[model samples]
Target: MTDLLHDARVSRGQFLRMMGGLAAAAFATACSTRPQTSTPSGGGQATTELKFIGVSDQKAPMDQLVAAYQKAKPSVRITASYAPTDQVQTSVRTQLGAGNAPDLHVVYPGSGSAMSMSQIAEAGLLADLSAQAWTRSIPEGFKPAFQLDGKTYIHSAGSSVIGAVYNKKAFEQAGVEAPPTTWSEFLSVCDRLKKAGLVPIALGAQTPWVTQLITYALVPSTVYAKDPTFDDKQLAGQTSFAQSGWREAMEMYLELQKRGFFNDNPNGTTFEQQTSMVATGKAAMAVQVSAVLPDFRKAASSPDDLSMFPLPGAGDAASVWIPAGVVVGLGAAAKGANVEEAKAFIDFLGKQENINAWAKAIAAIPLVQDASSTIDPAVESFLPFTKDRAVPFMDQRWPNAEVQPVHFAVIQELLAGESTIDEALRKMDEAYQK
Candidate 1:
């Protein structure tokens, strides 16, 4: 969901528009710890201090991870920092420029697009920890996010998938024996659920990222049909969000809305409320990530009742798998004799013990090459399908700076009936051309 987090009183719209801009500003504003007057890498075996930042929305597991990490590296002091999800990108960037960037930091990558943060890596603000043996353990297929152009720059601790989440009871109430697997079947299920007096698709229009998942579910099939490396291709500007299956995917979205599938005032709702709609049986299903499972569990009477399916598609091959994980890299601010020590902390994280702790902490699938790590059972059923062909969502990797906001606004407009599907695509085409 573009790494955005909910902040008190701030609407999702205001939050995301500020993401690219604020991400740069936040780090500068993040109180620099014990001011360092020099840019030279600090030296010494003296326990090098490392500042860390992670998202607060994910709990339970994170606290345990912090404890485990501290236990492993007694010599290094980590001042863990956390903020609303949307603020992280800005915060990290600010710290880097301020020379207070943590020795190791968390990054969420867009499938192919490289932005300001990657430039930091190019500038040597980040240390390359890939030479460590632990990284060799991260499995294949999941390495793209960390391995930029063959030379590994970042390391992924775990991985997750994007798909549709539904209430088992609601499906039964709608007389659906199982979740649909194809577009026609899905539409039929939506129709039955709607006829049964339930909102067919629970949408949090207020949190536009939630609405974007529908396209995420669809784009993979569209891209994979012509090329498996479609995501990488788009990242290179070989194709565009508006030119390919994206149009059909977006059309499917409008079709669902026009069919009266969404809950009332979807745009006014938040992701928390959208999950609640399915959890409480107010609606039939929602398009969400596997990471969303634990949250649904907390929101519902029985978390076990919530299940996932890769979004139904145009794929001749299989359903899609999209990455929803973090990228950890050594900091440019890391100087001194402890530079290697900071490198050691990152290496330590890749170890089976720390990697397992991080994955299980957040209920994440260890993307690292560890044979022992596993994902939640609900998400496990679909893992086999992810093995072959799948496309990352078009917007997740869209090259244009304006794509995210333009897509967000277009979806809202579609919901408001202010724009037709054709007009929406036309606008998208204009943005991509820019």
Candidate 2:
């Protein structure tokens, strides 16, 4: 599953579109702390101050990590800054390019995304973490995302899967006996939900990024599982989106729309509205990232109201594939002022207790090999797929940064009846050429 590497170039225009034309200041303000001098663990050290950045949605758990680290080693002061996920990526890229990156920052595990580990490592911006003790325990399959040219840089505590988060009570009310394990059954279930006066699927395409979730969820079984080399071929110019399995995966998306399984005006719905629909039982299901499970639970009257299942893209139940990856992890900036101290904090974050705590706080599957951490029960049903039946998010491996924007735009247009699947795929292929 980790055989092919994707292009990780992040363009300025891509960052701008990701923020929906929002100004840099529209992102959360950077949280800083007063500089203090104190000795840190790991023997010889000086009173050091560290600047850090992280994903805002996971701020709760990250705050716990900061507090824990400071408590254990009072000599080091960290000014931790967090932004919305996309903003974090953009900010890090912009800041890193300006030669003023944080001491430590969030990075995607592998060769995907604008702020992926490989991108930073390739730029010679990440401190090597290959010799760290915690790294020895990580399974081989999980190593590639954090490594570049056989050297490790990122210290990710866990991984995440993308799947459909469904309202349990709504399913029972709709007379849906079980989660579907095949595409046909999935459509049948949606029909039943609609018959029972429920929205089959709530899609908020107004948040353009949300438009890619359905495609990502289905491609694991449709494209990667069929040929793990599909991405490699794409990078080598041996294949095109219009001529590959992407057509089938996307046709499934059109099938849902054609069958009226999606909520009316998906093009007008915001992500918040989409989550609210499932939380309030207005919709039976939603395709979403596992990291946002807590958000879904918080908006619900009962936290257990939601559970996730692998998207049934395969025709039958025989070893279905899931979209999964090392969602986000930490990497020490190579040219920061407090390199040693930052590396120390990163090491502390790799401890068994910290890894488990971080994983639990964010509802992720622990990447540490011997850690006792377990995934959330809501996501447990899809665990089997993660072992060997999972594929990394396809967009992460795209040849050009512009490919994602093309993906978002084409999907939005398709959802709005402004484009067709063939046209969308052709546009993606053209983006790859650029």
Candidate 3:
């Protein structure tokens, strides 16, 4: 596990097998167990209060599961709050550094960012979750995302894909009958939407993390579809973003904006505004992770108004691919006073029923499925590509934390016309080598 963590690599075969298992697994029913609690010394019912800070994508699932946990374990109380990704990453990391972290906080899978599971675990800030029963069930290819040094530190329900979340009514309004299957067709669809007076794509570039989705959606088809070993090559210093399909992906991203397909003043728009635009049919679609489908649904007049389709990044349908990776999750703080209680709560979440609940709320596939597990219909179109064409989110295999933020910043700069693809990739390469 330590070697795997250090390597941060999962081969294409392994990844495919993991996806196969997720699609085929049929398991026996698993039961839920409540965390143990002790009575107060004064003889009154003892209560333990736990604090959790997570990102917006987690709110729906956490709200549902938290209520269920409270109902089952009245002695333990959890107060969870959520904020946008950029804010949570800054504030929660600060809390962790100051030794005043919440009992549990948001953790991204793999070692991509400052608050990723491996990064926090390496700093001795995350508690070991290896003892939990659910840790035993993590797919072999996904272990690197949840574990470091052979110990589980994070709990994510399942993986999600990055794609175009479109409003069906808006598509109809533009005279588009179906999702496009090729890059040229996609452009035609966008052109029609624009002609119909709808924003073809709702890009909220003002939000740092949202800036990367367009590139992420394109890279698998532009880069990995041609060379599946791209990550390995990049890790070995055999190639770079400036020297590969990443340039094409970046150019394709700008081509959309160059044609005025995006909402007006994208750099000034917020993620909330982007969601509202698509949900309300003011915009036809947004390139986003499937995990946030619930947020889009919540903001819409009818959840069924929206659905997802793989963004075709190549001119040929056969060459198109998608990005699928572990969703962001939470971890318990190692130094918290309620460490055991926090662990117990995580343990409770480990139950198959709770995993189903969490995954269902966010439209994710359950990490380990049983008869009860359900995959959202919106993502069904992506299943055919997941086993072969999909790649893990690029950051998951990045050698260090610096590269992702650099990627984010460069995208923003490129969007603002302050940088070129050459300069942007060069900046990312420098960060990668750091």
Candidate lDDT scores, in order, read 0.67, 0.85, 0.91
Model 3 Cα lDDT, one tens digit per residue, 1-434: 65674476877677679888766553322223444434363448788889999998899899999999999988888989999887998999899889999999999999878889888999999999999999999987678788888999999998899999999999999899999999999999999999999999999989877999999999999999999899889989999998999999999999999999998888899888999999999999999999889889999999899999999999999999899899889999999989999999999989999999998988987889899899999998998987788888999888788998898899889989999999999999999999
TM-scores of the candidates in the order shown = 0.80, 0.87, 0.85
Q: What is the C-alpha local distance difference test score of candidate 2?
A: 0.85
Number of the top-ranking candidate, with lDDT as the measure = 3
Model 1 C-alpha lDDT per residue in residues 146-172, reported as the tens digit of each score? 555555556556666777788889999
What ranges in model 1 sit over 4 Å off?
A: 1-47, 57-59, 110-117, 137-140, 232-238, 315-338, 369-371, 393-396, 429-434
Clashing pairs in 3: none
Better of 1 and 2 by TM-score: 2
Residue 306 alpha-carbon offset, candidate 1, angstroms: 1.2
Tell me which residue pairs clash in candidate 2.
38-75, 109-145
Which stretch of 10 consecutive residues in model 3 shows the poorest summed lDDT?
26-35
Candidate closer to the true structure by lDDT (higher is better), 1 or 3: 3
